[model samples]
Target: MIESISRRKLTVTQQLSASFLLVILIGSLLLSLPLMHNSNAPATTYLDHLFNTVSMVCVTGLSVVPVSQAYNGLGQLTAMLLMQIGGLGLVTLVSLSYYSLKQKMTLSDQSLLQSALSRSNSSGLRPYLFFIYKLTFCLEGVAALILMIDFIPRFGWGHGIFNSLFLAVSAFCNAGFDNFSTTSLTAYATNPIVNITVAFLIIAGGLGFANWLDLVRRFKAYWLEKPRHFKLAFQPLSIHTRLVLYTTATILLLGTVSGWLLELNNPGTLARLNPFQQGMVSFFQSVTMRTAGFATIDYQAANKSTNLLYMLQMIIGGAPGGTAGGIKVTVAALIFLLFKSELKGQKQVVFRNRSIPQALIRQTLTILIFFFLALLSGYFLLLITEPKLDSFSLLFEAISALATVGVSMDVTPNLSTAGRFIIMALMFFGRVGPITVLLSLLNKPEKNIRYAETDLTIA
Candidate 1:
């Protein structure tokens, strides 16, 4: 029975992986049409179109061509739709559709939804789906309103409103696809309104739906007048939620301060800005590092230390079940705690006074190893494909693609066709995950024979 269930789960994960690939393929075809290109812009190759589509659908946001120059109004709109669908998993949209039609979800559907959303269970799936849609739109609506406050006056109503809508969705979805073509958030680097609004949107989206739902429930319970309700309200957050929140806050804080310090004297990036502007850029980049791909300054022009810093941040990425991608903040935190515990000679790994299962630790280790291997393999392949590229930037690009954090050092556009294809594969694997891809290809075979345990030596 247990083996059957494991195989079933692996099947579900495979389905999810296949679903994302299909979405990207369809999106690429749509984007490759001649009608999608701007009138004055040069026609884009199918490979470029495929790369862009995968980047957008995966919500990684790296592009070979500047978005404004590569596509017309129609292409831009299509890209936005793809970003929304990708950021919110396909299962999420499907569940919403079923709820809208007043249809019940089958057991298989529930299992897929649970797996996609990384939820603990499928109880109250409908309400959760409803909440996700409501929260997403609400946040995007507010972000758009705030962004329009500045864009409308400068670009006029039509362009301003459109830009506001696109950016709000991009930020909230952590897609990082800026229509600005050239400058990105650099133009608004010192603008408190745009920076603060976008930062909030990125952080909120990266928090994951589960965290928001838990926070809302806890908040409502705390305000309840009934003793029973109050008692429920005062209950502490789940270990997952707490760990995500704590680790996210710590990452943002450290990233911001470190980025600011590293770039303070470098005239190429932040040194020219005023103190306030520098601080804003620092804070904005920090929020964006593990999540969105928006940039206020040219990261390539920054000091080597800063580039390495950003690379590490991108590798860590955002929380699971959120729009952001990476190994996930929780996984990284758990690994840290595990290492700390081991160093202290403890047998059982514990966090927040709760013991973590050995299975989870093993899972984290497996993911880390997979991530490193993928990064290393991609780096070597990229080197062979683009022999003239710098090793540091090449490695940075590989890691960014694998983590699905789309910040680039200007190397992506110059890559060979093979390099681009390699990146597309990395982005897809990163978005879905290494384990999911592996499981999608393998059959889980059950072994009935038992073997005696053997001890292995380790350092």
Candidate 2:
């Protein structure tokens, strides 16, 4: 025990979890201060602040209190800073600090940073990380400026500038915590500028930094006429980028079309709007489902079919190595390919003529399996804890927490203490990932021993 307390090293996952826990605790304490709340702020417990801090740090937008009513300007800014840090990730920001200070990173630090960014090659990791930071801040700044166009006259310079910047970061981070009251973006359901700007930021952030880097490289290669053919130029992109793009496009298209069709005649959702606004709203909602929490329509009043659609969409979320959450689009794509290959009686799972390794397939399956296990566990636990709440809504809340999507069904504020704690666990696991958390606890390697194979009947 004494030795354990001495100077010791931590694995990447442990470092990540510890850094995040530190931020969450510190943010919780600061935000819980009386100075952070408004003069007439609603009463709240330390648990409320902790839960909010966890949600913010996890980039899950679920909240037990209306941010505007409970907190003053300082608190809102603090929350925004939390979202920014969470979205960029602590590892990323720390690396930026090191780089800015002209400090050489140790090999261990480099490895940890690469792992955090889901990057493979360490040779160009620093450049790639810097590129990500530049792209993120640049996009956020542009979106903020655009948002101010609509926000200034409506909210005035002081509130407008701050709100614009806040929402821009929130949307880009996919954090979804809004100061616009408890209704989220429902009041701006038909506001095209707001919807389009927010949706664009969501997509840009959700695409993942690695994919963006690949795209930039391919574009530069094509522009210089090296291998001239666009196809050949982009051929250098990793299979991961291709799958993420394909899956993201497919999900967005399908989600938008299905949502439009499902909500066509439903007065509670898009029925009251014009066809154009309905289309816009449908598209926005589809984008938001990729871990962006803003909701133009009241999901509670939405069609049951739409609710089911959202749950499925929320589970198959945006690309990995970005602000977005859930099992990730790559996992969904791989699982689908795995099934398709098996159904076709193919010897190997192939995508784009390249067969995926068994190890990666196994990893994908592990992630999916653990994800569902956590989701289901949280759902059942919520049912037991919040027995009086609507079962469907409770299930939605559970999925939202576990996916780190933060889209609640008006069930968050009324949650009991146990329910909030359960949600917090789910949120933490969701953001850090089930495998990551498990790996932190049980990180030792197993003996490389094999046993004789045995067969079992499928039927």
Candidate 3:
């Protein structure tokens, strides 16, 4: 057991996972302090606080208690900090601190950062890290300004500015925990200013740092061109960047259009609004449903079809290396292409005239299968633990937990201890990724042994 522990300790992924767990435990203790909650509200339990800490640290918005009622100003700030760290990642944050302090990173530090961001090793890692922070804060600052346009007039200056900043960070992190009472963004469902700003933040954050770096490079080349050369032909994007953009756009379009059509006559959601308002709400929900947890409509009252659609969307999620979490857009796209190629009887799946490696296909399928397995396992556990809860609600909760998209069907708070524990484990696995967690458990291969291949027939 000690040898196994020692071996696992040497893995970068395991270390990172341990770091997050440590952070959550510490944050839970901090949040459980009596000072964190309002004096009039009931005393917050350690379990509830731990759940909130995991949710924030995972950037999953699931909560056993409403943010506004459970937390005072300090607790809210602590939650935001946790989300920021989770979104940026612990390694990125440490790297930035080192950069600020003029300290050189060791090889081990670089490896950890690379693993966390899933970025290829580069000589310019430090510069890229700086760029990430610069871009993140800049986007959040702009978003805060736009949000304040609505918040200020309603809540006044002091409260509005704080709320604006909080919301901006939450949106950018794709962390849906909001301090604005129970309804989330429902109050601003028709408010284009708030909806558009939050939606923009979420999308921008979900595009992933690598895609942003590619865009920046392209922009720089174009900007530096001479007037005569301004008509310069653009270089094509990298395959990864192109795939992420295409899949993201496709999902957003499909979700928005389908949501509009599906919920058009559903009274509690999109039906009561005018055409323009309905369009705005549809677009917002489409954006949020992918990863962000904010809801413009009461999803509990939404149709079963819409709920099912959201489950699929949550599973698909946003781009990798981004604030959003799920199976990842690239994996989803690859799986779709794999199906397309299979149906065409092609031995190789090709995208953009390039044949994808078999290893990648296998990896994608493995991740998807593990996700479903975890979801099924958690759903069954929830059914056993919370027998009174309906299957649909339990399944929805399980999916939400595993996808790290915390849009609950009014069932999260009411869950029993065992159910919460199951959800918490699912949240951790979802954020860290099932493949990652599995990989962390694995030690270096002692030897590579070739085995004869065997095939099994299927229907």
Candidate topping lDDT? 2
- Pairs clashing within candidate 3: none
lDDT of 3 by residue, 1-459 (tens): 112112444677776677678679878999999888877766668999999999998888899988888888898899889999988877678777777899777676776777777775646788888888999999999999988888999999988998999999999998898887776788888988999999999899889999999988978877776763534533456889889988999999999899899999989898888999998988888898778888888888899999899889999989988888889899999999999999999999999999998867877888888888888888888989999988898898898888888888888989999999999999998988753743543324435788999999997
- The runs of at least 3 residues in candidate 3 whose Cα sits more than 4 Å from the true structure, single-residue gaps closed, are 1-9, 226-235, 434-455
Query: For model 2, how does the per-residue alpha-carbon lDDT over 1-459 read when each residue is reduced to its tens digit?
Result: 111211227667777777788789889999999999999988898999999999999988999997888889999999999999988888778888778888888787876777778765578987888899999999999999999999999999999999999999999999988886778898898998899999999998889998998888878777988457755766788888888988999999999999999999989899889999999999999999898888889988898899899999999878988889899998899999999998999999999999998867877888888999999999999999998999999988888888888998899999999999999999999999753844443345646899999999998
Clashes of each: 0, 0, 0
Question: How well is each residue in 265-365 modelled by candidate 1, as lDDT tens digits?
Answer: 99988888999888889989888887588888887898889989998899888887789888889889989999899899999898888999876786787
On TM-score, who's better, 1 or 2?
A: 2
Question: Candidate 1: what lDDT?
Answer: 0.84
lDDT of every model, 2 decimals: 0.84, 0.87, 0.85
447 Cα displacement, candidate 3 (Å)? 8.2
The residue-level lDDT of candidate 3 at 130 comes to: 89
lDDT score, candidate 2, position 400: 87
TM-score of each: 0.92, 0.94, 0.94
Residue 414, candidate 2: alpha-carbon lDDT: 92
